[model samples]
Target: MEPDAPITIFGPDFPFAYDDWLTHPAGLGTVPDEALGTEVAIIGAGMAGMTAAYELMRMGLKPVVYEADRIGGRLRSEPFVEGEPEIAELGGMRFPISSRSFFHYVDTFGLRYSPFPNPLTEAAGSTVIDIGGQTLYARTLDDLPPIYREISEAWDSALERIAGFSGLQAAIAARDVTELKRRWNALVSQWDDRSFYDFLSTSTEFGSLTFRHRELFGQVGFGTGGWDSDFGNSMLEILRVVLTNCDTDQYLVVGGAEQVPHRLWTHAPQQITHWPAGTSLSSLHHGAPRAGVRSLRRLGPNRIEVTDRWGDTREFPAVIATCQAWLLSTEIDCDEALFSQDLWMALDRTRYMQSSKTFVMVDRPFWTDRDPVTGRDVLSMTLTDRLTRGTYLFDNGPDRPGVICLSYTWMSDSLKVLPHAVERRVELALAALRKIYPDLDIAEHIVGRPITVSWEDDPHFLGAFKGALPGHYRYNTRMYGHFHDQHTLPADEQGIFIAGDDVSFMPAWVEGAVQTGLNAVWGVMTHLGGRSHPDNPGPGDVYDALGPIDIGK
Candidate 1:
């Protein structure tokens, strides 16, 4: 951890208790040696690697996965208190239905889901927009200026049409960048130079309506602070995401988000080997005809050598590098130029926002303030300018009181250290609750302080996922371009294949990671005569099975 970095209860020096909790058996563990040298080698057991491994297994290929840390990478769920009815998620939470693939996977895996409570569920109906200390009234579309409202309504309608285009949907399903770009550009050109706020302001009849809409948009899209992002790009991306995931309907896994990966592993066969702890990949050596190719020695295209963390080197015909893109490009031996220089520059120009997930266990079922619109319990709340920005309230049922999980993203720049940051966040969350329910005293009702997880400082994932910048829309289509182009490496050669949300068709999210894994598998299969598992069909076949479903249809 950097000395000058912010302090939190979850930081390095905060004792290994939290670390121990994170690395528990349920967290992440290495596969035993007997499982080594399988058909494929997958590094990193996060969603991407795990999903890739699952897909590979479905294709009849059981790959050996190597993970330096716990499984589920950013999808962290831990017990706030031993013997509690439910565990708390310390990483990513709230999966929007807009992620069609993810939702399909959940359904296919037989996972259960339910809707999350709306934070505005309380009777104190007015939406509050707090900036610094001042609270402003939030306006709606009906309150907007006429001209701006008209344009916004028209633009929104147009966006909805673009999102529902069958070609765009097919392109996304196929992971075809060229096709997607052709469709996206055609749709985005309508408001190419306009900011979403500006468009809303100018297109509406009520300027106040535009301001209110921007305020809410700022809170949801870019935290509490108003976003300075390119409206055209952001709007298009948002619409595309909505259409892709079908977010008009949202759901949460009944057990928890972690259940998604658990199901994948459950579906895996027992014959698949799991490497034991302290086992290093360098110590293992394989002969020709291995399930997956291994690069061993530059000797005549048949062998290649791989050095593991323990300094042991072995040869293989092929290897899959399912690690972060930056790690795969620089740390592992690969063509640095596989990705366009502009892509790398764009990646460098972008920085992931830091987030700290804090899970709080409370004793009461507080639904006194029911939102008239959503009618669901307001378990989740987003604060405009506070240490704990978002909260997810889970109903533990009458038998057990509900638990509140508060997530704070983009906190690195606001605080000085991890410990202090967490403490301050807890204070703010408690204060916010008080503001929402003055009669409900938090200090007295508080069962435990929020347990925080800082993704920015974690060694495994240096940052959450790749974030986009103003002009980076071009690269959005290029995400995973290297993997899809089939030119990531020489035609006959194979080494490490990178897989993660950063290399997926969409932005950073669980669905992106899953898709990236599918893409990686395709790359690997293409290198091996298109031979995947005999019993299980590959992704291509899966796509074929889905048939040519039209998006708008």
Candidate 2:
């Protein structure tokens, strides 16, 4: 914990101190001598899968990783050209400092990062809000008209009125678990069935203002850009973001976001249980992870057989599936008998949100170049109701070429251009931006090919990340708590533990994936007859007594 780490993603759902557990002097745990070097199947090579694999290896267990596309998974960063440092973050960029668990690994490796250029933040020098064919430029909220400030105030007042915002945040900052759980558990029951729009539309503050206020609020959202896309999601989901400060104090990895997981894959802990000091996941598997998984079935009692895409099959004592739960039915040939009817239903009902991002590398940080007459930068971080919902500017340095996220959108906005190729996507983005910066010819500065991504279009990732809908609390609880409850399930079902951001209450954040992965580690250790140190108890050790609220179906 850094001095007074303002806020941590410490469970409003399951308040486990994963950050503390990771930094504890006492190691994770020790497996039995006989169980040492036992192979455990790890599906997916993303942050969640890699985190679990890294810890499992430190404990002297062999983690056989299966990656479908790339090792980084959603934490993907692609370069603009052959060897240039300027890169486009295809997925999982702009991480929050409150994501203590995810940063644990990043900080361990000393990965450099800078604050993200959010809508109104200092990192984004100036911001432009264009809506209804009108444009307003400002460096801060106060610089905007009174209406913008009113909208911001109303949101704060509404949160305090309806959710006890101050006290809730105070509890979290203070790390008061008892109060945090008591306040949060109550909120879960109240807001779980309610939608985010429902919270806004029904609030006394918002209700007092006109509908246009709500619209403006959506167009110019807090922390980042417009959150209108998440309007249909559960209020609990929205509250979690603000409560944990998930939307504020965000930073981007210097080299790339993918480096966190890639480094984890090859990281060698200072003190390992059964392996040599220099041992790492890369060394264990020779170099790269196994190809994607094709099928998963129970070979015998407490034994799971996994087949790779190329028809290579192997059985392991336990399997930690870090891939999206929805993929169990679609991408992999998972045996139906592996999970219970209720668990299967939860996995099936898990909804995902679509997302799209288009990026390009420019000759220089041209946005910083001021106009001769107006003395204003040529362009500013933009948020608009147009096709391009948000346009962010990234300045590498005077020496390196700057990168621009020409457009970033979600949900229906993303699906609008789902079928388009990268070139077509860039064209659409430019067409929309031209409306605001009509005089600026963005194409003149393009140095390399444009890069774009539509997660929904990708087979491996059917959607960006989990976004729970109203009345989906029961489903989230089932998926997240599965690691702890798996012990009571039937023999065949007990060993295959599920983990990922989708399996966590705080989905769409890397910390969610990291925390859930830690949970899976505890589940696997316990399943293999291992136990955590007495002083430092794992999540599973205290989960039954203090887990998520079970708001029954």
Candidate 3:
């Protein structure tokens, strides 16, 4: 990284330099002497919750973290067997390099990473696109037929026509907040009410081409795989992804993405305020977090009461809730008066997208071998229109066992096998792969039982992440702005806040979670009579001027 790295994840909606604010030498902020040793309740020990807790601990406050399950929430990586070292990444496997805030923690922990084997990238070695009863293999986009290249060109033209792709990206690279808001605010008004498919169909470039061109683009979309499942999502959601480069230059943590948060939980800041040099989040909690929070209610004047599942109740001056939004209504028995009716409406209306993954450990990296009949790989990283929407291959080493994500699907596709067991899911995937590679026997090489996860099926996480629909920008604004805007609310509601990717502009990205967590740090500090260093103003300081524009009623 450069000496002064520009934060690429600086929002198109809220253009705050979270990476810079976090890494600044001045530190996050300082709490009053009276507030020192004050306890803060952090519900759900996920990425956002953990980030806020860690930072708050640094400022001399004791953070009480509660978790329903393991330390890493959606960043789960389950080992294949009790004794085996290799594992399958059930969630958040691929991470984009442009997510500067997330990578900040990665570099801090001194963890290793490698390129994720996404479709059509050099790391994959080979990619196969199988659609409409036809199959083709490629080392790059140019290796495919002329029609595929034409579809790619059409998509590029469409983006350039509607989004001013080059200029907008230049602003992001330069961190020009003025030009960014001017252009992005205009887009929020025009595109907020439209769907991704609407953006594609209405573009003059795509309009000039045949319907088949659009269909082909959907099958082999840029970054990751087909995005047809996201056709129903708001156009603003898709634009934020491309504008922030969320889907490009992605890599996976060497062992698993879960290690990032785990390290944060145990990391001790060298120059922490109010605490001893060796004190860490783990030492503060006695090496174990509290049980899951079952209920939450306000106690007025910078006080909130939290009750764990085991009926252990505690009160704190400030609280940060990082669980999925839907969980507030369903799993946790939260009080009605903690927020306004409008806020509740926004939380209830937030839509979530479903996702599923199935994985199996193979004997070895056999897929990399060349076939006798054809001089190509025996099996390639695959994309298909079958039930198995996408298949990814992970090559551990020449001798070590390799792992294969047999099937990965989203939205409607994820629902198809949600009722089936892991074995059935693997069977369904292998059956689909047979059509793409008739001679290959994927099931025969499998050594152990398969592993799978349907995020929608998990009660704790009703769905994978928030996928806002058309006309839902108002709801998104209300949720994302709640922390800063809560100052106008009643005293009881002011100190209780929400943080997570679900409340951020760029949902599903780890950077969003980290940014919101930092926002909560600012909010909590200000509520407890603390202030950020004058040299480095926090998000709340710039929110009024730079926050997302409100599309008025």
Best by TM-score: 2
Ranking by lDDT: 2, 3, 1
TM-score, cand. 2 vs. native? 0.99
Q: Write the per-residue lDDT of candidate 2 for residues 1-553, one digit (tens) a residue.
A: 2466488788877788899899899977878898989999999999999999999999989999999889998999999886778889989999999999899999999899899999889999999999999988889998898888888999999999899998888888887778988998899889888999999999999999988999988887878888899999999999999999999999999989999999998888887889998999999999999999999999878889999999999999899999987789999999898998988999999999999999999999999988797788889999999998999999989988999999999999999888999899889999999989888888899888899999988889899998999999999888989988877888878899999999999889999999999999999998999999998899999898679887876
Error of 1 at 390 (Å): 2.6
The residue ranges of model 2 lying beyond 4 angstroms of the native Cα positions read 1-5
Positional deviation of residue 483's Cα in model 2 after best superposition, in angstroms: 0.8
Better of 1 and 3 by lDDT: 3
lDDT of 1 by residue, 145-209 (tens): 35434544554554444344555555555544456655655555543334455544564333545
- Give one digit per residue, the lDDT tens place, for model 3 in 1-553: 3445443888889998898998999998999999999999998888898899999999999999999888888899888886566789998999999988889999999999899999999889999999898899999999989888887887777778788877777778888899988889988999998999998888887888888878877877877999898898999999889888888889999888888889989998887888998898899999999999899987767668899999999988888999999899999998888888889999999899999999999999899999987899999999988999899999989888999999999998999999999989998999999999999898889988789999999989999999999999999998888889867888767888899999998889888889999999999999888899999999998999999998997
Q: List residue ranges in candidate 3 displaced over 4 A.
A: 1-7, 82-84
- Candidate 3 achieves a global lDDT of 0.89
Instruction: Arrange candidates, best TM-score first.
Output: 2, 3, 1
Deviation (Å) of 252 in candidate 3: 0.3
| Local distance difference test scores for all models | 0.50, 0.91, 0.89
Task: Tell me which of candidates 1 and 2 scores higher on lDDT.
Answer: 2
Clashing pairs in 2: none
Q: What is the lDDT of residue 238 in candidate 2?
A: 94
